[model samples]
Target chain A: MASTRSGTARRQYGVAALFTAPFFLLFGVFTLAPIGYGGWLSLHREQTDGLGLGGEPQQVFVGLDNFAQALTNTRFLGGFLTVGVYCAVYIPVMVAVAMVLALLLDSAYARAKRFFQLALYLPNIVPGLIAAMIWLYLYTPGLSPVVDLLDSVGVPFSLGSDAGAVGAVANLAIWEHTGYNVIIFFAALQAIPREVIEAATVDGAGGVRVAWSVKAPMIRGAVVIAVLFTVIGAMQLFTEPFILMDAATTINDSWTPSMYIYTLTRSYNLGGAAAASLILTVVLAAASFVVTRFSRKGATP
Target chain B: MSDVSTLTRPAAEAAPPAVTAPERRDRRGVPPLLSKGIVNGILLAATLWTVLPLTWLVISATKNYADLYQTGGFELARIRLWDNLVHLFTFGDGLYLEWLRNSLLYAGVGAAVSALISVMAGYAFDKFRFPGKERWFGLVLVGVLVPSAVTTVPLYLMASDLGMTNSFWGVFLPGLASPFGVYLGRVFSAAYVPDELLEATRVDGAGELRSFAQVAFPLLRPAFATLFLFGFTGGWNSFFLPLLMLSDHHLYPVSLGIFTWKESLAADSEIFYPLVMTGALVAIVPLVIAFFSLQRYWKAGLTAGAVK
Candidate 1:
């Protein structure tokens, strides 16, 4: 009986392993290995002897020198600062826009909520690269009716300038992401117990009042997660600026942290890139931790 | 068995409940606080904001080079949309078609395979108990937080080391391991696949794998659809990894292809502009169709993730 039960237990474990093995295998090879490799790469730099053309460059252990350099590099620092400004403008606008749309959809006064949801989410279906391309044309003078309209209104608009460029990119990000967050917020709103909402309604809470006082607080966790994702996403801004490089002169090869990493990698400064990546990851992780902790505290209270 | 029948009886009865709540609410005759006109106006404005760019894209695609440059951006000129489409497909030895094909293969196959892996793993995590299961899952949860961008450089390096850069597998392989998908899969499996059903199948002499395949998978079809849509869109929208892995234009997906065209527009604006605009429109059509047709699944996926 003991032997038979052990056989069954072993078979169960084997079946579980069989089912799970593929994910773990791919996860290790692609995810875990790169993380470990990146950490290792961050600590080393390529050493060259003579003209460095006669032989392969030697990778020497540098002991955080790359990290130190990445920290001080103005371009890298500037990229972080650029994204910082972007986050400042973007996070609040996106959150507010998404929340308002979600609240409106959840409201009794609204009609065709499904249509509005689909319409708003259309841009998100367009890849970030494609959206950026579309917006680039819109921001361009010759190709864009937007430019023509602005010109006719006697308002000069140019994505060529730094502020204009930032705003343009931010607008693209907002347009692409707001719908997604709206869906999230809308879902969270839908999950709120109907009795609670009815109670608020019975108490003569206005549509806006109920949305603010009841729905918002009820969906605070989703809101926090949305903000967290938006913040992380802002830090990893690549596709928009990468595509907009042709349209916006203000955006260079290293206009954001991910861009900086890409530039470094392309230039064969893999060590520096790795260090920068680790630093960026650490900062983001810290930010996420703080946000999670803060949100949890707020939730418990 | 008695408990199962008892639990299902109430659900079976409740499933056919009438739409009386809305009717009763209407009878209550409480006036809405917010004006319908104001709500509609706000919604209309938001919709316009969302739709206008795409409408511009459609219009721009229809315009020829001269019309594109000469006319007001929104004006529809002589329909050269066909001409643009022909040019886009025929351009540079039909590179756009190749890109489209590559994208379809990558996103379609990648999403399907990834979803399968995710579902299987998620099912295991849900239905099975083993040593280190929680620890393994915790690692996956941590993997969720590790931004894919942060891993790109390292992945590139690792791929290059293995001489996998510029190869399809480099991009295809990494796209398969979606930690979020696994997380979602687990959530879905737990929600959709009841333990008792699995036990019943097991008692009927079905093996664990057999029970999962025949009994649980059918029930998890909705979840699978949701996961597939999520993975498909993710793969379709992926740009950076492909950009990093692929240098050859032949391997370029539509996103990269359109980007390259946009880059060339600086040197030769007149020729590349219409082609790029047209290509962007064509490239987005598939995704737009998928989203519109499979919107419910997409919404379900998002809500599932959000709730978690």
Candidate 2:
């Protein structure tokens, strides 16, 4: 009986391993191994012989030189700063809009909640590239009725200018993301016990007061997660600006850190690109850690 | 606060019955009218804000190029949507169809295979007690936090090394490794799949694989559908990876294909603009249908991800 039991235990382990093998295999190859390779690549540089293109390029260890160069690169630094401005505008607006929309949907006074929820989430269903494309036409002068209407009304609404271009991209991000976060916030709102809300309403709290004091506090965890994800997303802004690059002159080859990395990779500056990627990764990791830790503290008591 | 509660107690009890008639008129099934107008008005504005661009896309796609530029923003000058669709499908040897096909293949096949892998891993993690399980699961949690965008550059480098760049496999293979899907699978499996059933199958002399295939797999249908939709949308919507990996236009997904057309509009706006708008419309149809039909699953998935 002991031997039979041991055999059964071993067989279970074998079966478990078989079931899990594909995930770990793909994860190691596509996720883990590339990350390790990127780290190694960051520490090395490609050196060429005389005339800089004559012979086989030699891979030479560069220690921290590539990282230093990446940090000082004006375009990379500018992209980082650009995203900083973007986050400042985007995070607060998105969180606030999502929270407001979710609250309104969750409220008793709001009619046609299902229709509103689906309508609001419609943009999110559109692919990011397609969303960018749709907005690209919307922001264009001759093609956009918006531009024509604004021109007729004499509002001078043009995304051709530098600040206007940034605002246009921010608007695209806001439109694409608000619905997704709204759904999350709405879900979180639903999770709040009905009795707590009833108790608040019975205590004579008005709509605004109940939403602000009761509903908002209760879904703080979802709010924090939304804010953190938005921050991380803002740091990775690429496709919107990339698709809009031709529409606006303000958007250059390197409009964000990811764009800068893309430009570097396109130019075959692998070491510098890898170094920059690592730096961005570190920043992202640190920000996520801080947000999670901060939210955890807030959640406890 | 106590004084306020006491003062409002009588009013609160009296308000519900008083508000019932108006509540019956209200579709939201709530007993409040003071804020109804304000709330509905705001919601209408928000809905318009969300929908106007899409509505514009549909309307604009129906207009001829001349009418699109000449007419007012909201006016339907002429109905040319069918003509635009024809031109879109037949343009450049039907490259748009090819792109649509590529997207469907990439998203469809990638999602199916990925869902299977995730479900299997999740089931294993949930049903079996194994050494180092917690440690392995922790790695997956870390994977969830490590944004896939940061890894794309390295993935590109690795793909180039393998000479898989510009191939369908390049995009398809990396998409299969979704840590979030695995996490979801585990969560769903734990909630849905009963271990007692597996044990009963085992006692019935069923092999492990057979028990899983016969007993557990059927039970995981909802999870499979949820994961499939998640992965499908993810793969369909993916842009940066395919952009980085694929240089060939023929291999481009709809997102990248439409983007290329949009880029061409910069040089010559008139020719490609309508084509792109129409193509954009076509690309989003499947997703919109999926959104409307599978809303409950999406809601369940979102709340599941959030609460965890």
Candidate 3:
């Protein structure tokens, strides 16, 4: 009996391993190994001999020098500030826009909800790079009707300026994401128990009042998750700034963290780039931890 | 099972059932605190804001180089959209076509295989008990947090060391292991596939692999489709990794190709500018079509990730 049971257990183990082996192999070799390799790369520096002109640069061990340099690098920290300002502008504006649209769609006064939903969710289909490209054209002076319209309205708009760069990038992100989040917020609103809204209605709560007081609060979990995910996603801000750099003269190679890393790679500073990548990963991992924890709490209720 | 049904439900029939109650109340006599005109007006304005850039892209695609420069974005001139597309296709001995083909190959093949790998792992996690299962899953969850951009430099380093840089394999290989997809797959397997079905298949003398292929995988189709669409968009949207790995123009995805074209615009604005505009439109058309046709899957995918 013991031998038979052991045979069954062994068979189950073999089957399970067969099922899971492909994922583990790919994840380990591609994802896990790179992470470990990046850490190792982060601890070394490439050094050249004899005026640095002839031989291949030998990678020499460097003890925390890259991290120290990254810590003190203004361009690196400036990238963080750029992203911070972006998040400051982006998160509230996007959430508010999405929330308002969702509430309006959920309201009794709205018509053609499906049409509106599809219309709004359209931009999410465009790739981020393409979205940035589209916006780049729109930000162009003579080519853009938007620019023409602003010019005609007596508003000076130059995407090349720092403030303009921030606004342009933020607007591009807003245009791309607002409608998608609207769908999310709208779905969360739909999932709210009908009785609660009715109860609020019975208490003489007006439409706006009930939307703000009851509906928004009830879907607060979704709102929180959306915000947190947006924050995490914001850290990967590369395509927009990378594309915008061509048009916006003020935007440079190291204008964002991902851009900073890319610039490092472009200059053949792999160790420094790897260190920056590790720092970014650690920050993102912490944010992700918060997301997972909050998500679990959100799921429970 | 119910989650799958709701996810797969036709959009027309999926309207909020609770909408009628409020509509009835409004008709009975409660004055809306926000005016009807105001609410709809806000929505209309929001819709316009969302639709305008796409509309601009379409209109801009139609203008010639001269008209593109001379005319405003909304100005409709002699329609050169077809001409521009021809130019885009025929440019530099058909470079754009190569980019498009590369994109389709990467996104299409990469997403399909990635989804399958995820589903297999997810099925194992959900249906089987094993030593160190939770620990392995925790590692995957950690992967879900490691942003792909951060890993790109390291991946590029490792790939170059392996002599795989500037090749399709470098970009293609990394995209296949999405930990989030694995996580979603586990959730889907638990929700959609019952262990009793697997047990019955076992009793019927089917092998483990055979049961998974014939019995469980069929039920996991919705999850698979959702995962595929998610992977598809991700692969399609991926730009940085390819930008790092690929140097040969022939291997460039449409996104990177377009960026190269845009970069050249500073030198030859008259030629590359119109091409970039038309190229952006062409590149997005497939994705737009896919999104519309597979709207349900994307919606389901978004909610799954968001809720998780």
Greater lDDT among 1 and 3 belongs to 3
* Candidate closest to the true structure, highest TM-score: 1
- lDDT values for all models: 0.84, 0.83, 0.84
Error of 1 at B83 (Å): 1.3
In Å, residue A120's CA in model 2 sits off its true spot by 1.0
* Model number with the top DockQ: 3
State the DockQ of every prediction: 0.47, 0.44, 0.50
Better of 1 and 2 by TM-score: 1
Residue B245 displacement (Å), model 3: 1.0
- State the fraction of real interface contacts model 3 keeps: 0.60
CA-based DockQ, model 3:
0.50
- Candidate 1 residue lDDT tens string, A1-301: 2336667677878998999899999999898899899999999998786775787788899999999999999999999999988888888998999999899888888899889988888888888888887788788887777787889999888878888878888999999988898888887788666666676665566777878887777677677778888888889999898888876888999999999999999999999999999999998998888877897686555
Please provide, for model 2 over A171-288, each residue's C-alpha lDDT reduced to its tens digit, 9 standing for 90 to 100.
8999998998888888778867665666566656767888988777767767776777788888989989988887788899988999999999899999888899989988888888
Model 1: per-residue lDDT, tens digit, B1-308?
11211222232232223333542342245655547878888988998989999998899999877888788777889998888899889989999999999998899888889999999999998888888888988888888888886688999988898899999898888989888888888888988998998877766777887788889999888777888888878888899888889999999888888878887876887889888889989988888777777776888888777654
lDDT (tens digit, per residue) of candidate 2 on B120-202: 99999888878898889889878887776667888998999889998999998999988888888888888888888887787
TM-score of 3: 0.91
Task: Report model 2's interface C-alpha RMSD after superposition on the true interface residues.
Answer: 6.9
Instruction: Evaluate model 1: give its TM-score.
Output: 0.93
Docking outcome class, model 1: acceptable
